[model samples]
Target: SELSEIHSALKEIEELESDNAGAEAPKNLAGAIKVQVDRVIRAYRTLLGMSGHAQEVLEVGENPDEEWKNVWLLLRRDLQKSMPRGSELEKAWHEAFNVDAEVAFEAALEVRDLAALMLVGVRYPFAPAALRATKASADLAFAEGQRALAAKGYSALMALEPFQSVSRQDLALAAIKGYLCTRELGWRKAEGEFKSWIDANPAAAVLWGEERKPIGALLLDFEKAIPSFDTLELQLGESLVSMPMATLAGQPSKAEPKNLETQAWPSLKIKGPLSPRTSYAMKNLLEVEVSPVIPTVTPTSILVNTGEALYGFDFLSGKSLWGDGVRLEAPRDAFHYSEQDPNLILTAARWQDLVIAPLENPLSKSTDAPKAKSSFGGSVFSHFPVVRRALVGVDQASGNILWTLGGQYRLRSDQASLPDLEKRIAVTSFFTLTVVDDVIYALGTTRENESQLHLVAIDPAQGKPMWSVLLGAGQGESNMFGNPMRDAMPGIPVVAEGVLYVQSNLGAVMAVEIASQRVLWVSRYEALPRPFTRIRSTAYRKVTHANGAPILTRDKKGNLLLIVAPTDSRFITAFDAESGEVRWRTQTENAQ
Candidate 1:
């Protein structure tokens, strides 16, 4: 009966708190509820042989001395031991949390004196039930604007693996609020914590809406006062990225002319190499891939995948933000670097916590096709190693793996239909994963036909499939020796104004409507060499990895032009974006 009365009083206090009553209201409610809890604790203590421990706690009201913390520790142990498994007090505690979180918060605080008890190493049980009760109570504290109490709750929850998923974001948010609410601890610790949260969830830096500006202002003040050059640099860079492009450029750049007639040039000019220097230190190219297509640029940070590990670094500082380098799955091959070979690990895309990368066979000395077997079995070609897929999602902040969506290309040759064995080949390849409107689209292929390709869309939020469509047979590829390796060019998917353009290795380009996922149009061309062109034994060609990636550029009239260069050829075709109509076709003698 006393337990039920105390629970009722606790519930009433929580209801007032939930109503967001005046500041004095909670203290008044807690004060009244505290008296009842004291009586219950006293009764329970005598029954559990814990007399005289907390007698002073009740007599002195809420101003329990430091000794009260130890009293609670002994009282909790004896109370749990003495109370029957289904005692009224235990039932009350459970119901108080389940029905009214405020009640649980008040009750737990009044009896165990949470903050004071925590200082004395007195903690609730770590069992799942205990964890849930603690979390529920802590959540109420946050709801009531009790920053310190909420931070304590989050700290404990973070240490428990099972609760980490639920607690991490809330804990981060709570830490931000706690830092703002108190200056008892040095501002450096608070400032560092606030910045850490931003790095962990860059997207969340502006999560507070109108409050974001104030937070930014506070951070600016800290930056000015703090002696850390790195922190100031980071804050400055963050501010710059938040600015509009026009503001950063000083003046708005001229936009493409809406109705200017398209012009044709005689040849693509070789102004300079893509990089300022023609040579690339393979060791430092985490962003670049085998495909000639350039890496995606992030304004504030650089994200790169070196096959073995995904790395995030501060663009300004050149310091690593996070990486799984210590636990590398496959180290980079020293021989390939010595030989100036194209690194096989390709970084697909990086956006906040979502990083898409694909790892291929790193040990392959060459991307060249195997030589055809000599007639009469004079010399048989070696078996091609199985090609595996290594597309994966990594959390950029923590360098933790989110999901892996790649596999080795294989077929059921044993149960083969005649066409199956003829076309079945295990070829490992990395397809670039593109994100459009929060949906992830990546190219996939079947061994049955190199010309055939699949466009797979996934929900990057959870790495789940949204839809997959076969875009029909396109083209095939060949080795430098002009031998058929596979048909179909594996071009990176490019999105322009909600339309996706994909190219098969052989040179069939198609545009798909992003929203409807429908093929808008298909354009085919002879992009690969028709007959075998023998690559003479020379070092002029150097590394033989070639990707016929389709390029998306705005025409003179502001319309997107899909330009594609045929593999091993000098012909380039530009197609109208909306209608897939050929805009212009050109050929050059010495350009690829």
Candidate 2:
């Protein structure tokens, strides 16, 4: 009955296409046809939701109904040709995942849906080694003297293999190219293809000589064939741990013994010194400020924070690719150092398909009476309003804002609340968002009284809050006349080994277990009196200046060390990463 109903809808669309033979397709009529197609898609999606579909997804031996299979094939064909991209249609397309993984993959490939094919590949248990079958098929073709067809098959199979099989697949591709080289005209084509491969995989390409190599040699230690981690000249800031790219690509890394003394201070070539006034101010500011530059590199791109914006740059050219592209306002001062630093204000975490970052201004703010103060209480950007922040998800390809998490921040309820600095501080808490294991850890504070810190966990895939844990009270209330706690530099939150290390301006270092959503250990370094006033008769209040991100690294013995350096203090403490036991403590001057 449902099959007939779907066919009837399909017939209606065919009739509409016939009617539009000469003139343009009418918009209203097209809309009506879309409604019918959507009905069939919804029905198919509903069937996919049924428990029967679960058998087709998880149990390979159990066959799906032949009638249902044919029904889906017809629906898929129609949808692939006419269905506009929409959430419902996408959901329906995703439902094509089946127990028969090979068939499912072919269906997706036929539709040119790479995303859907990837989804099916992940869901299919045998898809990782699906290349083995293709390899065997190509071998048969090659043995039968079908050189052209076999070469084409080998190229297609190379495209399908996972990264782990990359070495083996490259060898397979080399063999096919070798076969092409034996022919007179095909030698040029083979040379061109080899050059292309060499460009893409220079390290892997080096193993092969200018002439073709035996296919067997192509499998020569893929691990060693890959480039070493040292190839990337990543500029990780002082007190940072770097991960080797090869290790992340599933290659085992040998732990090289490092001399801590020599590694501590990198050789420096100073251009010159700042002016006396500026130098003095910088020294004092450096004591309380921690400028962290977290760099993430992909094969094609490099991402870095320049204090003003999160930038994606072309890997080879070092030219700017795409920026967060969020501009606050026109700078009043010639320096352009306004309420928004605009240089390194945004931090980002890269996931599978999204670049999640802290949305500095979570909500739209009023532009009428714009006013922003610099660290020295001087007007940096003239007439620029204070921009508060929240978490925003950006599309990796287009660098567009896909979704935003966290509440919108409006400094003033109306024009009258414009001067309320307390509300401004509450709405804007220093946050460092880091992505690990497909989850985004948002370490910051909500715009609330008492200025309590909020650590939120978000699912980057759907841009939804998974869980949240409240930490220590923020650097306390704002002091208008005295040293404002908001201006105090915040320690960046670092995520490593499934734990988040965050230090607030209040001088508290917390190790939070991300999965458990609980504090592992809290190390409070120091605290000072709040309101920052000297009143012998009044009650004593204290505040902290521990606002920089903690650094995590492994020592020579392979024991993980969590380094906590408080911005206010000259001392840095090292703790055992797993047990939270104090390993060592050293003064910043002595250590550096």
Candidate 3:
């Protein structure tokens, strides 16, 4: 029956090839035939070992009734003679099959090998089928370890083309799983490959698109996958690439980094329905040297800074109740001022230095001055008395300065001349001051130097330094000037529960025990490894408001608002304070 089937298959192949003589025949047919004959020969050899003479008779080329041995030898010789001398069939048989079968099968395959290929396909259809079957079996093995098996299956499928839609779907799923499971195989590579394949087969978009959504979602699951700076770069690059020809007609071909930087740091425009109108001004103009203090008290009074003195106004009615416009001699351009209490204002007067003026009566009119100067102990009343820097303080009536403080401290000149003065004190310049309780903080740089930051605690009552901490070592006057002003520290020191929270410009956040002058805890901000230029170039603005407790805002690289809680384990939280809490989270971004 097997012999008859082989004969029938041979006839069918012969007729098919004959009909396709004008067309290209299947290319691998000869190799396929050799594979089949090799298997049959092995089986015969095994059978001969089991049944001796009987198998030998069956193996002969001729009938047993007609000298089968001679006939068999003759048939084998003829087959060998018919084979092509130098072909793939000859090489395959030689490498893969036994020597005897190699010679015989090579001969048989070369003779248009219909019988051999068909016989092999029928008997051991399993050679290639087994490979396909093993692949399915391996996929099932994933039941034990889904990720590992899925990865292996994906690799295998990626090397071959799928014959069916189901097969393609399976392969795609495996690829997605593999990408998700292996960190070594990053999402970028996987996405790239997927995209490339989709591009090659545009029609597969429907199938691939369905798969892409999940893969994309999986990629997004990795919090640190795509950096914000990189995203920005891509966005900018795309925008540039997509620019209309008309738009670029007169412009330069390339955009400079400076141009991008300038465009990026635009001053925020306060506009919209919620924005305060420009015509709106607090009533009762009072001049204080410091930034205004907004009191939390009902019918709150906001203290305003007038050129020389401090004044308080009722926030509701915007009415100024009282102000002492006392013209005291302040440091040259003595804008250095602050209000400790709505009634008590501290101003750094020009030549005489510091002065603390106290208003005698509230809601009382008349240019009557108090009888004696309120004693903060020292004749010098302002915490900052440096010649070039302003002063900061809180007004007597409102306690709003608890969060915001500003003043400048200048190093005075020994010589009468301005140039000589700049040389003597190394002229460190501080333009802003912050006072917490009795401690006063100054943020500024020296003349012809980098910005300098100094934390000085003073007896507000006596105008004396309790303690002073210099942020950086001063690189004094140089013939060739460098920016002596270092970056301002990330956030101001939050003084709460007798402890101070300080964040360094270098991203180091430290908690200091004020009394002991000891660092309680230290934490570093999560930032990309980049040069300080990228960091310093970013915009930062401090935000202050009472949220559960007093929360201080420090912009991290101009992209994130770090809301640091000084009293609560020094927890530095984040929120999109400008847009509300909707998009409050920290994400990494590449630095340009």
Candidate 4:
């Protein structure tokens, strides 16, 4: 019955296409097709809700109804041709995902209705690999001989595979595909390490299925080619276990014994002092009430956000400019930035000559969150849920609120729209914000869903977004590897030569072409979930977690290299920007 209804809907769409046959047909068909596609998507959703879509996904064998399969194929062909971009359905999908529908469809293993939902929206909080069958896409890319795509795809998939949403079956399949791709590409995935992986994971045996024989025939070794834990020497700090980095289509790294201390260091060419001393001491300008924030410095002055107010200071003299500071109502707590003190790095942009800064302004404080038992313990309030923040433009000369964007920023609500859902959607906390040619680029997660990161370009003067793209790993993913008491580390984005390079603390680096917002590649260094390093605060009685940032550098060969020390504590990894492949990783966690 549902199949007949879906056909009727498609027939209506076809008839409308035919009826409006002319140069003006597409213009006329836009509204009608929207309605019909809406019908088609709803019907499929209802059908999937009733059947084998147990994990909120319908795969090849999940529902093998031949008639339904044909119905979907017909619907998919039509929708692929006529489904208009920028529709409400697409907006909803984009609201929750970064990749377009087709890529998501391929990731979902060619589920026709999945494609429809791409034009439509997924019910989010997905159980799939970052909201799609990214593993399947990588496998196809490898089969098609697209090494770069396959490498990056597998890189991203492996990093995200550890999340709770990904099933063990899917993870095992990913590993098997990884083994095959490595073998085909001649990349250095020693059979020994793979066998070790299977040995450690007996579950992979059950899913090995047909691939078992071929993989078995290949030279097998019980010992790993890469050095095992016995060869690992723990520094006094971290014990981040590592995994095979074969997904990048790069050569396996040769073991370098810890001779780093004996190696000669490069000269910095500084003629004079190697270390600098503080030039000025300016205190009492403002009290460290609720933790501290790294101030925004300009050529003439600095803008300081104390979580309760905006303070202006004379850069030349480091003296307070405003008395009592321009106190902000419902100021956000700053304790969440770090465990012991404030995270000293935050960005501030200039719009219409006003300082644009992200400040947390809470709605209501929750009692369930951990409170500080020590001094200025009120700062601990910012660490809890139900916090709202905004990008505020402040008058540099007078410390006046000029304009505020996103969420119901109470300071100047009239300048920004207020929505009940604003708590989750607004551009709240960003790791990096930069203004290039008058357009502001921001990368951060939402207050509600820290893992759902968004990269947005904004018109600072108008306080509106020009366009926004979701980055990776969204829909409320868990920070399984991060410090249990803290949120996942947000990746700091570095833009160069029109490409944006970002890394998830989960151990993957991604490059996006800025002009088209296309994700060029991802290189992953997925490691087994281990306890992250954290520091306990004696003053605040709270534990501080490890935080690392990435930077862009060029080698002597003039090639771009992305270097980052993920909180994983294994090694500081470097990736080739052009190919998204691992260039090198330090032998030890603290080395270099």
Each prediction's RMSD to truth: 23.0, 21.9, 27.6, 23.7
- What's the lDDT for all of these models? 0.47, 0.48, 0.34, 0.48
Candidate 1 local Cα displacement, residue 100, angstroms: 64
lDDT (10s digit) by residue, model 2, range 503-584: 6655567788876888888776644433322221111221122233566777754477888765455667788877777788
TM-score of 2: 0.42
> lDDT value for candidate 1?
0.47
- The C-alpha local distance difference test score for the whole of candidate 2 amounts to 0.48
TM-score of every candidate = 0.41, 0.42, 0.27, 0.41
Off by over 4 Å in 2: 1-294, 306-308, 323-346, 362-386, 411-430, 481-484, 487-490, 526-549, 553-559, 578-581, 590-592
For residue 545, model 1's alpha carbon misses the true position, in angstroms, by 8.2
Q: Which candidate should be chosen as best, given TM-score against the real structure?
A: 2
lDDT of 4 by residue, 57-151 (tens): 34445533322333443344455444344333333333333444445455455553323332212222122423355555565665655554455
Off by over 4 Å in 1: 1-293, 306-309, 321-345, 361-378, 409-430, 449-451, 474-484, 526-560, 565-567, 590-592
Backbone clashes in candidate 3 total 48
The digit string of per-residue lDDT tens for model 1 on 489-573 reads 2455666545778766445678887668789999876554434222221111211124424667765434678887755445678
